[model samples]
Target: MKKQQGLSVIAILLVLALVGAGLMLVFKIVPVYTEYGDVKNALTALSAETNVGEQTLRQEFDGKANVSGVTSVKGENLMVVAGAGSNYLRAKYQREVPLFGNVSLLFHFDTQAGQPPAQ
Candidate 1:
């Protein structure tokens, strides 16, 4: 009998299963990261806005989050720090995406923006 030169049926099925799982993970994860990017941008924009107080900044951030569909961090949870006559904004949050059944992926994001004091 001629020797087999290609993958067996079982081997092919296993490879296909792995590839499918990888694609599924990618599909589930990319959107979460995209949302994180939007959150970062929102924080940075709020930091740069002139003449906005802490409460106003929190409100604006909430508005931005609503518009961007970011559900991880609410305006009430944002950390506002006062330093050297300036305000700083920090956002620390986490997102969870289900992979399969009870399995899930957790992602944490921390972002901060503000001016630094002179050296």
Candidate 2:
């Protein structure tokens, strides 16, 4: 009987620990990873428009690294350009404290000068 009770108690404690760890990871690491991915995507998109369109993107967070880049490359079959512009560029990069910080970026977004957002 005591052995069974002890086993049950151990199981409960293990479950609680797992939950706590999950919460911490969720609040910390996720946001930063997300922000990084977003930056990559936005830059890629901005590079697509070339000299013709105004791209608007948001900075994910306001911090020391709140920076965005734009570049263009020409290939035999495809031309690639990506990055946001001054008038239309915007984004919010957020680093959640613990776990969620790794993936806090809610989304990666970029827009051309004329088209509207998808519904």
Strongest candidate by TM-score: 1
TM-score, every prediction: 0.85, 0.37
Which portions of model 1 miss their true places by more than 4 Å? 82-86, 116-119
**Candidate with the greatest lDDT versus the true structure:** 1
Tens-place lDDT digits, model 2, residues 1-119: 35433457788999999999888767655555655564545544544443443312222212113443221111111222232332223332323242243643333333223222334
Clashes of 1: 0
The Cα RMSD in angstroms, rounded to one decimal, for candidate 1 relative to the true structure is 2.8
RMSD of each: 2.8, 10.9
Per-residue lDDT of model 1, residues 1-119, tens digit only: 99879999999999999999899988998899898888889887877777667788899889999999988899889887545445678888888888777999999888888863346
| lDDT of the candidates, in the order given | 0.83, 0.39
Q: In model 1, what are the clashing residue pairs, if there are any?
A: none
